[model samples]
Target: MNKRSLIYSGTLIFLFMVAFLIFTEQKKESPSGVVNISVQEAKGMVEKGDVFVLDVRTPDEFNSSHIKGATLIPVSNASGSNLSSNRLLEARIDEVPKKKILVYCRSGRRSVSASTMLVNAGYSEVYNMAGGINAWIDAGYPVVSSEDKETDGSQN
Candidate 1:
């Protein structure tokens, strides 16, 4: 090949490599619109009342224990593999309200899935609680049972 042709090819290859690296680095980061936060950060946000806590766990799990003020929005069924078929959330999307929504589950995996769904649904300011309620409990944060909520409501 001619020297000029070889130089041109090498420059194009170098530019392609640079662009590929940048794209891959960005892919490694979290989804563009969703923010993953630690339990501590989540607690602070919840306390500030600036975030709407959306529990994506099953109804049984949520009734057993959940963050106070969290609205139950199960993204999975008993088998825990129906996240992609999240028709419940889809049908009730309006119930979520437009706000900074903080999503969580038992171990954080499902919350990630739900966060992506919310972002795709055009709900900006979405947050996934890293480690989920498991992390929150391990960090000594308080959780309320469904019974507690019932009693509190009855007394009020």
Candidate 2:
């Protein structure tokens, strides 16, 4: 090949690489718009009432114990598999009022799945609680049982 032709080909290849790298960086910064945050940070946001906290644990687990004011949307059933390939969260996307939503489970595993589901459902700001409710309890936060809540006369 001629020298000029070789130079032209090299320039096109370099431009393609640069474009690809930029696209990858953008994806990393906002992968489907899901962010993983610590429980402490989630608590602060919850205290401020700026985020909608989603509890993805089972109904029984949620009834037995749960963070105050968290919305229950159990991602999985008793079998450890969620409905519709975990698209259950997607179906309830409209229930989330706030632009930013925080999610948690018994541990951190299900929260990650729930977060990913939310992002795919077009939620722009989804935060997964790193250690879930277990971490929150370990951090000395309070959780209320269903019976306690019912008798507290704080029903809304």
Q: Give the top-scoring candidate (lDDT).
A: 1
lDDT at residue 80 of model 2 (Cα atoms) = 58
lDDT by residue for model 2 (30-146), tens: 355678788788889989998888988777677777888888887777445445634455566677764889899977888888888888877777888888888888887777877
Q: lDDT per residue, candidate 1, 51-109, as tens digits?
A: 99999887767777888999988776644545455546766777897899999998888
List CA RMSD, all candidates.
Answer: 8.8, 9.3
Off by over 4 Å in 1: 1-29, 78-87, 149-156
* TM-score for all models, in order of appearance: 0.71, 0.68
Candidate lDDT scores, in order, read: 0.81, 0.76
Candidate 2 stretches with Cα past 4 Å from truth are 1-32, 79-88, 148-156
Task: For residue 42, give model 2's deviation from the true position in Å.
Answer: 0.9
Provide the lowest-lDDT 10-residue window in model 2.
147-156
Best by TM-score: 1
Alpha carbon lDDT at 70, candidate 1: 95
